[model samples]
Target: MRRTREEAEQTKESIFQAGIELLATKGIHETSMSDIARAAGVSRGAIYWHFENKEALLREIRGRLQSFYKSLVDAAHIDSAPLAESISRAVRKLFKKYRNDAAFRRLQDLNIKISVLYAGKDSFADDIIKTEEADIQLFCEAVEGSPATNSCSPLQMFMIMESLVGGLLIRQYIRQELLSDEDIDAAVAFMVKGFSGIEEKTKTIHQEQ
Candidate 1:
């Protein structure tokens, strides 16, 4: 009997989730279609039916992860809120999401490995760079729309915010530090202060210019 469309989608999701788990634990180089099938509790043929190969599955996983992060960022809608409030909220949500998502945390580890291996030679690096640029642009636009718009150029503030967030993530991942809710709040407050200070400096510079 042929499976229903919903069943097919369910199976696909199962396979994808299983693949993510295996990829996180075993690394992409160590994982095979057979391993994915076994982890997914599906047939090897079923894995093929859903994805052409391991690389295809990896690409799909990357796309799904990217889409998930993009949606989270979009949901913050920082452009409509006051500058300080928006930045605070956005950082809080980001840390909350990172803390809650085991899969995402694992993915970040895997991505770091991939980055080190590919570094300057991989097309994937270009893709990641473009994605980061797009994220920064969205953040800058939101900052520009805030009440603090006159305080700083959107681009300058975004660069500062991005650097702080990136640094925090690296430290968290590398040191395996315990990140509590209070820590997140404090970090966000610090970031907000840094953003405000930079903006004020930029405004002063512009006035002088």
Candidate 2:
């Protein structure tokens, strides 16, 4: 018998959830489609119905995470605020999500695992950075929208900002140091004040010119 659209959607969500849990506990290479099927309480055929292979399934998982991050970016939107403040709010918003949301944290853990553990692999490793493409765009827009746009290329600015976030996350994940409340404040300061100096320097040069 054919499944209802809602049933198909639920099965897909179940497969995603099960895949995330297994990827975290078992690692990507170790987990199989059958394992995901068993964990999701679906048959192997059901798994294949949604994904052609494990790589496709992994990409789908990353897609969901990308959307989640996009939502965070969207929620942090402060149109009336200055670009730096708006972007800072977005970053802080994400940090809060990381601290408070178990699923968000696990998704991050899974992200690090895919990017780091499978760096040499084919599709898995590719998906890691591919998922970040939208965020890079988000940061680009934020930086270009700022008064500091004259100081550097938006891509350069995006890389610098994302690096700060990525470095902190990797270090914290490795060292098992949960971010202190102070760290969140420091993040905002770093993002905001970091560019303040750049903007000032650019203004001086432009005035001199």
Q: Number of the top candidate by lDDT?
A: 2
Clashing pairs in 2: none
Return the TM-score for each candidate structure.
0.75, 0.85
lDDT of 2 by residue, 24-115 (tens): 88989999999999999999999999987888876765676675446535633556866567667767776777777789888877777766
Candidate 2 least-lDDT 10 residues:
68-77
Q: Which stretches of candidate 2 lie over 4 Å from their true place?
A: 67-79, 122-145
- 176 Cα displacement, candidate 2 (Å): 2.5
| C-alpha lDDT values of all predictions | 0.71, 0.76
